[model samples]
Target: MSDRRILPSQLERMVYETIRDEIVSGALRPGEQLVEGRLAAELGVSKTPVREALIRLQRDGLVEIAPYRGARVIVPVDDDIAEITELRVCLETFIARDIAARRPTDVLEALETSIAGSCKALADRAEEQFVDRLSDFSDILAEACGNKRMKKILGDLRSVLHFIGNSSRRIQGRAARSIAQHEAILEAIKAGDPDAAAEATAVHIRSIAEDCRKAQVPNGDGRLPGPAANAPRAKARTRARANR
Candidate 1:
């Protein structure tokens, strides 16, 4: 059997995907500095690929690079969140309508499976799994929507929204509500009611936007609160300790 080893370019892409997932999953937190050396050490690669990976992430609008200051995760501003929400409302509503109109058996089954998984995750208090499965449900709809361009656009928008969603789900009662909303959308789709599916999708997107807004930092800086604000300072302290 041939060795199934990753190539250098593939390794760089792997690093990029790993970091991007962490950011979207909220494990990295917004505004956190991405130290190349640390990531390189953790991933068992040279700093070169890590640096390249950061550059790739920067191009994807997930990281910000500064001259001589290294890279940091890009925190979604209020306008960024607002614009993404609006776009998602428009695009995802259309996607839901398309899926409902088509009612492909395979796609509908996938969505149903995702919804069931999401419910179980929520019931079990598996927050991370619930979020992932919920996104999977939407992704299924998007993919089956029969519009490649819209799918690509929604995918990009959802990456940013995923971060906000990770924060929004932390609010009391939010996860249960989201699960119910997803079920509504799925039911509408199963009924092959385009209008109902679109309406359900719109409601769900609006609720998510509202929850994210409520969770926004109150410091007038339009940034995510809590860990996002503290991450930079925490990184600085870690660096100081390392130097000492």
Candidate 2:
């Protein structure tokens, strides 16, 4: 990638967001080294801003910084996926229940709009847009529940969840299934059925977790399987050897 300089005042936050988006979009694959100098050059910023961004990414659990080894994308293992899945199930189910009981018209309308956008994206085979809309759908429901703290927690988890979802949804039929699940949850909420909404949310999360598990790729050594094997880094390696 070419250098893209950030303005002085926006350096830190912009650098962090840029790198985070790259990681989430799989442009920076898992386990790929994030060299300070290289990222600085590519981002057209000084090493200082890049260093600060790496620290923030590390804090977000998206990167791991070693003392002398620099930073690398943290590969999401099965355990990591499972833990995130459980947390989402707990928080989102509660949010669904609350939203269902409250029955906020504005929130419902926002969710419907998101679902409609998602359907259009899927029909067009626009994977990125589809996932973005799905995330928006979840965020609207969570915000509607009116728990600021819970909403903040969910926001904190959004990047990693999106990364996982992007990987899992690549599987055949997974994206369609997810849309159906979201529809079910929305239907329950529209009907003012808290219990049904909660159940639907739980089921959706569990299904996503299962799909993520199936999408995991075995590690290079055929041990310690992780999601990294499915990443671009692995494909690059395969191509490198094939051309030899």
Candidate 3:
């Protein structure tokens, strides 16, 4: 005796999650255009739901829409990345301090479970799941942060940071290093050392920005400096020719 009808709001939320996940996972890519008619046809829904979902995405900071230009994924420039990194460092460091002072046992257990899953995913070389594990790990920290508004702020930034995090994973030796960093932060939290935990959180978040910088490719993905990024390599190639 359950209602089997799909509500319009339900449909919109589903479309929102699908598109958001696609964007976050890099399938949609930064600055990729989102066409309403096309997406509606593809999702077998009407344009209304797609349009509404897009507005919600815009509210989430995941998309930018113009009156006529349509919608595109938000592309984070280097300055955007730096500003976001600093903000996260501050917020997460504060969360670490709060959690350390409180030392909630349930939160600690949840973090332990998340870390175990991440470790296993890494061991099995499951790249996609590993990124999800990273999100879960951050979520656990956000939940334990002792402020609802702070948790929401972190959650709002999660997708953007998640994309940047996946970009960071492309760096050589970064995965192991990331796992180690997460552990360091957790260990400090467990020890109830607020200063240690805060420092670890700051360092871990900062490392992500560094890794993302190292992982940027020239003229691709909008990380910038890309226009002239190849000049040095080109110059090196020219030097080899001159030597010959």
Q: How many residue pairs clash in each candidate?
A: 0, 0, 0
Give per-residue CA lDDT, model 2, range 174-210, as digits (tens).
8789889999999999999999999999999888878
Query: In model 3, how large is the Cα lDDT of residue 186?
Result: 90
In order of lDDT, best first, we have: 2, 3, 1
Q: Estimate each model's TM-score.
A: 0.82, 0.83, 0.81
Pitting candidate 1 against candidate 3, the one with the higher TM-score is: 1
lDDT of 3 by residue, 66-170 (tens): 988999987667897799899998898999999988889999998888888889988987766777786787888887766888888887888778877766766
Candidate number with the higher lDDT (2 or 3): 2
TM-score of 2: 0.83
Model 3: how far residue 9 lies from native, Å = 1.3
Q: Rank order by TM-score, top first?
A: 2, 1, 3
Clashing pairs in 1: none
Q: Model 1, poorest ten-residue lDDT window?
A: 228-237
Query: Lowest-lDDT window of 10 residues in candidate 3?
Result: 224-233
